[model samples]
Target: MAGRESLPLRRLKLFQPLNRLTDDQLILLASRAERRTHSPGQKVVERGVRDGMDYFLVAGTVELKAGDGRTSKIEAGGEKALTAVARLQPRMYDVVAVASCDFLVVEQDILNQMLRDAPLIQADLDSMVDETSGGTDEHRLLMEFYAELRSNQVSLPSVPDVAWKVRRTADRENSTAEEVASAITADPSIAAKLVRACNSPLYRGFNDVRNVREAVIRLGTRTTRQLVTVFAMREVFSTKQPFLQKSIDALWKHSREVAALSWVLADRATRIDPDEALLAGLLHDIGAVPVLVHAEHYARLFADANLLDHALGELKSDVGAAILEAWSFPATFVEVARHAEDWQYECRQDLPQLVDVVQVAQLHAMIAAQQNADLPQFEDVPAYRRLGGLELNASRSLQMLTEARARVDEVHRLLAIH
Candidate 1:
């Protein structure tokens, strides 16, 4: 087969999103993309490699062979060529060049960052998606879940009565540390956890405070209430499905890290309350719990993590907001859970709120996860700006970062990560 001429950057069908990129952005992406040429019959990428690359066929054709032996040929400039199999861990398929071909490979992380920063790229992808199924099965499921939540048919998760009393006491204008402690004492398990948390390195006082009221006074009423509520949250993370256990554990782990980071970052901004930020971070991804719970009924969706992740990404925020409201949380925390993924969101305030702190903290968590990768610098993230111009390596930021890192064990204990 004859090779076709190369298309301009803006005209390449495999890169419709690139059309919206500024010249500088396009140049930067081109610099990062690894270009390669392959002859006919050459395998482009093998399955299960975890290369994390999205391949774009710039010229000629390639045959995609699924793990199940199904095959489809995608040609350059073809409508189907726009998207690679999205970040399918364990590599869902293998691409083999069917003719002399040119390819551009971009890392999945880099592309995701671009999509996050550029609404234009998202809009372009949405348009392409609209060409296919108007309402995806996963989306339909999310809609049904929302309707059920609103109708009170799906029975939202509720904390134990003891936890509710602690929250109510803390919400009062004249509530004292003694009252908060008494409420926690009503639940022995929660009281024990609160004592342990008070002794933990994250908030350990100068000396041990054995009594519940003394511990509450030492940790402050607000902190005590937050801990009590989160203690109840730890119990709900459990599931009967053995396979789903790992997913639940991972969700709690991520939430713990986010919470720790949020608490540390909150101290830097006066307007943001560390206790509120901590709770917000802990529950930011709370929507995933119910989604996973319902998914247990659909074995196919429940088993395929990549598919579930896709659905969660699409619906978690909306479900999270609903969950928070049902729990009677304040509007600020509810909005934080609802807009957890919106890193660029800015509130009209003199200083940042819990949402802003959680956003930046989440970014830090992401950076820590990609320990060995050449991840984007904190400065590149737009959220870093909204966070009071915070820097990961600055003197004050570094101090907090060091403290947060050292308290990882405490976070693990709080979230029951073990």
Candidate 2:
């Protein structure tokens, strides 16, 4: 709820010449939208991420990248907003916000509420969808808008200096929570995001928390400290990069989904630490940032968005591996990152096996969420297959995972992880 300080209702483009909606309903809903900014070459949206309704480019230029790494540029008053054809799938490609742009980020819950109130948007959407077949003129116009954005610079964040110190500790099993907390505290912004999240309604009732120390104590020193680390990471490294931002919402959802599933998977399928698996699931995609960072404006690299998936498998295809290595994630996590897209680890190690459970369960939840293309190769994953083979067990795990996903979706949204 930041910018648009004086305007009544904003009617920015949504793809040219097809679906135009600047109704009072959309504007009233947009009144709830806050302004956000991004720099050039920064990854705005990471693929496979989920986000609520947002009328991006309330100001400034934006580039839209396809799943195959195909890039398109959009200028203000362009075709796509009118077209509504090229909305991003965060679970797939990064949408980098270029040129210090101002965005109108509307919360999902709010957007849904707004949609219910505004019948015109639905009408416009039906018109937009109905008007399309085999790449409608609207979609093409939006794609052209996307083409313009390709050259726009996206804002990306550089890891904080102390991030170097934390990655070093990853290799050590003997490392203590106190050490990590100390490092996290070094970055005030990280401390702030952590403290704010803990204090939010999500955890507000968990305890009568006062400060980081008390919050950490209430959550358990280890869990509390780990949350701090995550906060530090996003704070230090998150930027207005449109490409990276795409999947950020989905990544946040997926991580939480995996965390929820990890607990159940550990309870039923594997012998790994549920807490550790949760950490692994949440951090596994940390490698993605590095890939985007290395790609720069070469949005053309992923011409097929699914190629990013392939890139994950053979990260040698992308710079993800080196970025993970540089980010100082654990060797286990780094190894897990390497095998995350694959069915299993080459060595059949305990961590990788646990990671596989996480990966599969994430895909299962994604499939259930009905948000992506292609099912994960379940047959190839011996562990998940065996787990899935048990009727009662599989049903029970899915039940738990479904409930967890619901809880986490609510929780992360309340926390603004997207």
lDDT of 2 at 184: 55
Off by over 4 Å in 1: 1-153, 268-271, 371-382, 388-404, 414-418
Clashing residue pairs in candidate 1 are: none
Indicate the worst ten consecutive residues by lDDT in candidate 2: 146-155
Tens-place lDDT digits, model 1, residues 216-304 = 98888877888888788887777888988898998888898888888777865445777778788999999888777777765642344
All candidates' TM-scores? Answer: 0.61, 0.48
What is each predicted model's overall lDDT from 0 to 1?
0.67, 0.49
lDDT of 1: 0.67
Residue lDDT tens for model 2, 1-418: 2455523443432422111224664566556666666777766566666664344564556666645344556565532333221232233345676666656565545544433333322343335434433235433333332222221112223445554454444334676655655665676666566567667654676456555555554555555644545544544334468766665655566666665565556655566655456666666666555444444444544444553444333332113233343343444555555556555534344333555666666666677788547554555555566555444244566676666565556444533553
* C-alpha RMSD of each candidate structure in angstroms: 19.6, 18.7
Choose the strongest candidate by lDDT: 1
Q: Give lDDT: candidate 2, residue 10.
A: 32
